[model samples]
Target: MQGIIDRQLDVLIYPEIGMDPMSVQLASLRLAPVQVATWGHPETTGLPTIDYYLSAEELEPPRAQENYTEQLITLPNLGCFYRPWGGEAIRLDLGKLGIDPRSPLLLCPGMPFKYARQHDWVFAEIARRLGRCQFVFFIPEVTNLAEALRRRLEAVFAQYGLNFDEYVIFIPWLNGPAFDGLLERADVFLDTIGFSGFNTAMQAVEQGSPIVTREGRFLRGRLASGILKRIGLQELIAGSEEDYISLAVKLIRDGEYRDRVRKRIETERHVLFEDMAPIRALENFLAKVAN
Candidate 1:
């Protein structure tokens, strides 16, 4: 680390951290390396070694950067990391999963546990509104701390009188192939706030399920709104909690709107893959770094 700083490296890329004493040591020397942070929350470290915090337009002026530091450089819309399963290629055996294709299956890819607490309430309300409808929730494998948090969330569900066994069927995480199968069996995909499921949402949409999401201040929240808007499904994007619940309830109750969203998503699935915005941004970023 000392040698790299002494040599004045072109760039140094690393993930975000809360606070590391070593960063203070590095910053004291006034290192000129261009630091880039990715994947985690778009925040600042207030370290002088850190020259730039890289992030998408959605996360522009990352919360930490806004409140703590001014080292953020907002990138153009680089798009999400995951792609939806192309609708035409997805196939499923509903009977094997004990799901009846004839019955409405509301598929929520993963529980909103981390930052989106509203999902807990939204999903519970969804279960209440669509009583007895088969709702399949795919629970992701969380680590030690995250697992503990998930347990607390589950307890909250019970407190709200939501019977996980009756309304929701918990499915273990699967590999790509198995996940695709689940998507095929699902009738609709639900999104969380402050950060939508980019890959999961796209897969659900591609698999012919209409995705319903709420917009928020950050990129994590605005993803669904942006994608739906881009693909001409703006009507499916909810503006608030009430709007999200109303849309979900309407989709479950109004056959015409539900079918229309489904068909429209299927018809427009290709556009997401073919879109050039993400590609161009990636190319530009790579070029800048290379130079």
Candidate 2:
């Protein structure tokens, strides 16, 4: 660590840190004079030595800087350049998975840990309100925590008066092509609140599926929203839990509105993918810090 720091790196960024203990340990050390935290985890590292949290200006909400201990450096646009994984490919067959082709399908793709326990109520509420819809959940191969989450969600359904069979389908992770195929079949992609899904949202948008996102106070929470903004579809951005549920239900049920957003995503998506404003913002920040 000392050797790397000795080379005089003007900026060393810990892309994401909170989840990994080693990152926290390294963060405890003053490695770089202008060390920055970025969207890898998108939350505060709470390290005194870590100087800044670089995020998109539009991605964060008002007063978002208040959330972090370090000085906040909100970049305009995405704050980074990225590419969507995989490409146009064969989608998964819903029939093989026992999913009815006619049913409204909502895909929630994220790690089990990203799904907070309190979020079950939102799912339960959606089910109760929508009355009929299928939620596809991708669980990790290791069943311990994922299975526990399924059971807990089932309980939430019961508590919320959802008496439907197999309302939530728990399945194993799909490989890139198969996952893209499955994403093609979904009508609405529900983003995990708090810690948003950046790549998953991109994949879903690439598949031309409308997504429901709620902008969070933190940078992590606003990732998917930033992506959505890139595509020029703010109607899908939900401001509250009720708004999230309403937008999801609307996207699931209203074919016209859903198709409009899907069309926007398909036709205007290039604006979202290749913008270099963020790269410029980052470069400027590095230059300013170095000076």
Candidate 3:
């Protein structure tokens, strides 16, 4: 703290304070006259020293201030300049990967911890509704966590009179082209409920795969929703758990609608990538606050 004080910085912008205990403790002190927090960990710091919570306008719902202890400052259009991801995906045959081309492939690539127990039923219900489909999950570094989640999901599937093993498949995590190839093969990208996937969702968009996400109450949950909204694909964002399931099913079952969605995404998704408005807004905010 004294080192920071000695430097006499103009302003201090801290991100992901919640991820580290020591960082949180340092943020509690008045290290800077203007200390602002951004959405590395997407929740309020709940510390009095945090003067502002910087979030995106599209990311926050109406009256979002109530969820934060610090004063809220919303930047425009996803709040960052993000370059579109483009790469050569190494072609891998789905059959060899144990994925059936005939079955609808719904990708759920979020970490196991992001899968809330209450939302586990959504997968089983989707499987039941579709009659035949495959839900793909990536096996995390810790294999035991995946097993734990698999056990819970199996219980949920049993209630619906379906075998979890029949509808779900877990594959080892892939990198670069391999992962991109998997994204391209996906029929629908299922954004995790309660906690959304920001970069993964963006990568899915880059592949032009349709996504279904529930706009969460907090910033952490609303990332994919904001991305969809910015790209004019708000139809893909759901308000409730049932809505999420229905949207996922529609993306899978409605061929024409799905094509139209893909076309629209290919055309409009450019708005999300290489945006400078948010950067300009951020610069202006910093200048205004520092002075």
- Write model 2 residue lDDT over 17-109, tens digit each, in one string: 876888888878888778888878877888889888887776878888789888888776776666766466676678788776777998989
lDDT of 1 by residue, 69-93 (tens): 5355555453544454443443667
Better of 1 and 2 by TM-score: 2
Q: In model 3, how large is the Cα lDDT of residue 91? A: 81
Candidate whose lDDT is highest: 3
Name the top TM-score candidate. 3
Give the deviation of candidate 3 from the true structure as CA RMSD. Answer: 1.3
Tell me how candidate 1 scores on lDDT. 0.63
> Using TM-score as the measure, what is the rank order of every candidate, best first?
3, 2, 1
| Candidates sorted on lDDT, descending | 3, 2, 1
Show where candidate 3 strays beyond 4 Å. none
- Candidate 3 versus the native: TM-score? 0.96
Checking candidate 2 for backbone clashes, the offending pairs are: 16-41, 91-181, 92-181
